[model samples]
Target: MDMWSYFYTCLVSVWLHRLYVYSAVAFGISLWIVIQFTTTRTKRKGKKSHRNPSSPEGTSDKVGNGCAPRQAQEVHVAGVKIFYGSQTGTAKRFAKALAEAVTSLNLPVEVINMGDYDPEDGLAEETSSRNICVFLVATYTEGQPPESAAWFCKWLEEAANDFRVGKSFLQGLRYAVFGLGNSAYVDHYNTAEELFETSSEEEAGGTDSVVDVEDLGNIMGNMKKAKREQELQEGAAGAERREMITPALREALTKQGYKLIGSHSGVKLCRWTKSMLRGRGGCYKHTFYGIESHRCMEATPSLACANKCVFCWRHHTNPVGTEWRWKMDQPELILQEALEKHQNMIRQFKGVSGVKAARLEEALAVKHCALSLVGEPIMYPHINSFVRLLHQHGISTFLVTNAQFPEEIRRLEPVTQLYVSVDASTKESLRRIDRPLFKDFWQRFLDSLKALAEKQQRTVYRLTLVKAWNVDELKAYADLISLGKPDFIEVKGVTYCGESSASSLTMANVPWHGEVVSFVRELARLLPDYGIACEHEHSNCLLLAHSKFQVDGEWRTWIDYGRFQELVREHQRSGGSRTFTAADYTARTPPWALFGARERGFDPLDVRFQRKNKARDISGC
Candidate 1:
């Protein structure tokens, strides 16, 4: 009784205590669950006021503004039916809404995604010729159209224009286009910008002095870099426009023997935004043209870079984890492969007749080249020697750089004109805007500016203006300009669309001509040495240069073709090797232009309406 009875009693008391604790825990848990359920239900029923979650930064509604109430859906019910040439689903969403709007209007239409169709099946010219074509294309990396649209666009450009397969061909086919792109993307505005021109460099090898607008890849850059040189060359010959081309395009065009003539002839490279570049249709217009004419040349090219800038147009898909893509090719080999690819591009365009004998013969004869396409061409170890090789063939080259590597810039040969993109005014602003990968990028940029000032070759400083971001640094900009003393200064606005639309940009934020004039005018006061030489409203940019450096203090616009040719010969004689100290070069090179070209206020968006309205007449053969 003392031991066993006590042990049993103690056990019973302990069991009772345990039961009591368990009951209390269970009760508390039940109450908590009940409370949570009641609160959630109350919120769901709107017993408590609820707020819609705000969209993540850079993911706001990209359609029209909020002057009216938010519509039932994000779709624009009155827009054109979009047939997107896209690989990803983004273009699909855009096309769906576009199709819905067209459907609402009771218009019989087909809203097609290129991926859903087979590009291998040759589209009959009669089928395509009868209808108005609407191309909503998205470009892939390396300026290649999306896989879905790739073969389709290739076929369309290289073959669909032929009159034999379907008689009339694309002769009467009218079309409108809306390219979906992110300026952050590098190639073809994410591939949508490959639809404007089909045969920019179709040389018949005769005395046909037709200047092809589609052949120029650096047309935008030309307006900034080589406008004066071209103006000097043209000298009111017929009409003078700016020419631009990318380095890659330069290489390709060299392989093809097409020269960038004026501001409208070259490549327009930038991050997407709304301002002068996009408002004017030419940026993408000419780009669309280039993609059509040439198949992307480099297949297994290097994809490495030394610096990573903030305002880069490259997409997230770019290889950031790795330093290179290996399988590098010589410039001449790259040019050869590119030419072969170009033939394929033409073959795809040539319909049932296959390759026209004339076209095939023309393809055999090659001409000029450019080097500024996607990556920083200067970063290539063999850039100098490669440029020399093109020069040897009378191929004009335009080398563009971010000024990240001044040493490369110093070693660069005399091309048509060299471009250095200076994105900010001050060191701090430079860091904020360019977001350099290296610690000493700011210093490197300064050295580049000074080097550009010193170079005997034509040096241009390109300043891209992003509203609300770099609009306030007028004084700082003037200071930087003073240091560089560039022959030409091109101030352009960011293109707002695609990936950049995710950021805080508005049409209102896009500085108008008046705004740009005001800013440049202010900077002009500080930069008394540099005058506002010319203004092009269609491009949404301005040009400035040192007054003392001007040739006649008037609009000094001319390119000494003879001089350029002489320099090429000299470069070749020296094994394309020369230590180009910017200091020594600029010392003897006279200022070519007064930067006094008048301000012509024009709107490119308005021109787009005209282009779209007369699409067939403008693009058709």
Candidate 2:
């Protein structure tokens, strides 16, 4: 093999292992070769030593056996550094995937385990280079930092104090953190909340009782101040609000132990109201959007999920409770209210347009990117009608469903992109991971996958790879995928969180992105018909499969929005409620009658990055 191909294969192999130590070794070796081969002669100007493939000043001398060469030192500029402090492995797995997403930018990145470094010595103090720090820290028992994070916490605190006390430690330091913990944990829950709350306690105190009359006289001014105060308050409260607990829930959770951790009310997105506006809401390093543009969309309009997956990062009641059917809204009303609130949020941020003025307006206007928000949005009974309403407004919809509801999938019109989360390959593992609502959920999921294959709209089969539970089913999963024949198959690692924490699910059980990638690629190799499509190296997600849709006579894969809208509209009219049957679920959507997928002109990367432009951010109860 040629040098580049050989190096790429080696790098891919090392990354696929999912063991950080091994990956680091491979990274170091590859860096040395690249630096040796790519270095060129250079001249020094003044005192600054101009060395070919020169290291970033002090960084060159700060060496270790695992050191990367000067060219390798530039990894940070291209890729994000993901430092995960995890007890079992959830944070690490999530961090890996996040890093993959960051790498998808085509920038190289180095993913390191917090456990591998000696905090005081390992973490770089000063460097003439820019590196984005993405930390995924998970807290453990009694609301304490996880065991693996012990050194990281001590070192981080010591480093902070050292910088402040001696006045010279954090020179080039810049970072972001994602705290993985349950609100149910009484004390340290939402511990990362402090990462964003910058204002003083005094400001919070004053905002508590600002009279309504003060708001009327200076509407904009008072509202802005109030919003800022509330944002800070929410920041603090978000940091402090432990998930509400009751005796029964606690008892049930205690029995499940680690599995219970998977039961957290997934990080609820910040809600927006006229009361929470702040001057061009500055992005917080720890906020959801700051981590992934995928998280940037302003609202999760609905929160009704269908299947209660075993490893979901959602509370038990969120899936099983009987109270949900009571609170609901019409699709039209929700779109109107959500958009109006989003627009108002954008207006509030217009004050700080600053250098980002060119794209500020587009960012703030909430274009609907609705993921069946939480609960089984498809189960709404009027799901077909709802999707039609979304399409009418040119909104993009992402419907995530547990395969349990093939009946619903069949009845509804084709959505923007339909996602079927496949957690297990066989009935046994399926039951263990997804304690189904019905005894036949396994069969239903299989049936759903088969049905999804026939839908004319874009389809993506998602497999959440959990380490201990179903990692052994790689071959079986491939067989299942072959049976379904999806257009795109995405493999992602299961985060060690939510209700699963109450059971055996722990950070230790979380597999890194590379491990996931390796598994998926192997499956891809086995199923030669499928090709590796897109990959988010940092996020540890791999998209594989054949492109079935024809875009301007070119075979490709992506949602055909125009055609999707037509089908939704058609279903709304001709295929009335009475016409729906099990056969309708697999009914072929004729793409010939529908319009083609339009070339969106703009880069999706840009859209993903600049999307957070503003509006009321609401969380469905």
Candidate 3:
């Protein structure tokens, strides 16, 4: 410029011009960015993944059950794959809420159970489809994943390190893991989350997307509610809950085809009754004893129990208490309604599939009563009279008790066979398995056994063997048997009821029929006097009869029902002073019903049907 001045002036002008152009370019670029963002958002808002956003939650989503029809849709975000593993339904709920929130954004979302979803086949598809996989995983004791997600988590961990599973392995696949845990045990669950994060550390982006469902406002609020629920479940707010039998529970029971009698007692038609009515065979009782399954009424005088056993068939929904507190219905009224309702229910199966007309007619005339349906019948104030009422109707009674009440056991009138649940041998094991409400539960259990030993009628110790729980305590179980000296020992594999909040029991806990036989065979060697009387293969149950039930090398496990009823009447007439002994009503055990037979305790006269992957009707009954 100018030499000094001219050059300075030129330089200033040139510099100013360059500055103006640079500023303009920067502004234009910023404006373009803003417009592009707005347009993209507007377009996205207009688009829907073929689902009505206004529809109720869980109405339109594709859940991956093999039988449920899946909805076909194509639109919106890459996809939201919500893979949930739930133990107590909390993680499942979180996944549902998140799915609902994502749906509002017009995103194609799927809520899949990790148990149902095979990572081996479908995980690669997620990566190729450009979907963001979200894991809502729940972990329990010792940082263990929920049973539903165990395979999933294990697959992921192994695949991440496995050389053969390259494409499916989470190398570039995007994922977000949200660990679920109750407030009670934070660290236990966080360990699971950390482990998952470490497994997928490479693929996860720094930014995360989180949306809240309307009902579950925030994590803290949801956690607070969960705490309250947990407290209620722990019986801290027992009074806040309704009576033993609430209207809601009553309605639910009625819907499930239960015969609710007099606000307390209930009767449900046993599946065995249905089975025998169809000539499919009688239940274990029909095999082990002389009770006709088609003619048995499964009922309970009390709708309450004292123990929260891990394998409770009712899912622990029935009320629990240490003592009787609910309104007690008269024995006569309960029996009347139970029989009427049972007969009415039996009538409905008149023309149903696989029902036999002749057997249906036989089922209408109740001859045996199983007072072990849902609760402790002994808890009823007038259970003795209830038993008497059943006997008066010519219904032989087989009652089951959890052995929490010793005095009640002593006062209980003679039943055809009285069962005391010896779920575990040791005190610690019993506490873990039964979860009894009484502080002196162990003592009460021992005393109940003592009381049972004094009864003239047949007495049994029911051993429900849960694999990895009580199966290894051979010596301890033998010790308990010595203490009670029960007339019979019924050892059964714990039945898996399938995904109950009341228990964390999985299919693993259920021992195979062969395994049950192995256990029974081993246990039989420990006791010299008790012999393995019979085995019900279908039920995975084994019976050990005292030497008394074995007469001249033949088993007399079956009950003489007519003789038992006669003895019950005699005892009643004599004011309970002249009770009869179990031997007086003993009946000969048939060859087919004996242990290690080809029929495996199934009545050879009846048809046999194989049910695959179905749960047993009762665990300990």
Q: Once superposed on the true structure, which residue ranges of model 1 sit more than 4 Å away at CA? A: 1-311, 320-327, 340-370, 500-509, 574-621
Global local distance difference test of model 2: 0.52
lDDT of 2 by residue, 241-310 (tens): 3232344654644454211211221112232211122222222110111112222233343343544555
Which runs in model 2 stand beyond 4 Å of their true positions?
1-302, 317-328, 342-355, 496-504, 547-555, 559-621
**15-54 in candidate 3: lDDT tens per residue?**
8799887999999999999999999988765654434533
In model 2, the Cα lDDT at residue 10 comes to: 88
Task: Highest TM-score: give the candidate number.
Answer: 3
lDDT of 1 by residue, 1-621 (tens): 799999999899988799888999999999999999999998765721332222111222332222334332232112233467765566777777767755664445677776566533523332333233455776544346666676666665555345443423433333455566544333234334545444211211122332221222344345445756765667658553322343554565445433222211222212211111222222321221111112122221223344344445432222221122232445666444545544453444334332234433443333334354445666655666666666565545556777877777777667656788878877776765664545566788888888877777666778878777788998888787778777767777665444432133455556776777788888778876777765555556777755644444444423443456666686567875743322222222212212232214222222332355555322111
Give me the candidate number with maximum lDDT. Answer: 3
Could you tally the backbone clashes for each prediction? 76, 56, 4
Poorest 10 consecutive residues by lDDT, candidate 1 = 288-297
Taking all chains together, each candidate's TM-score versus the true structure is 0.45, 0.45, 0.63
* Alpha carbon deviation, residue 497, candidate 1 (Å): 3.1
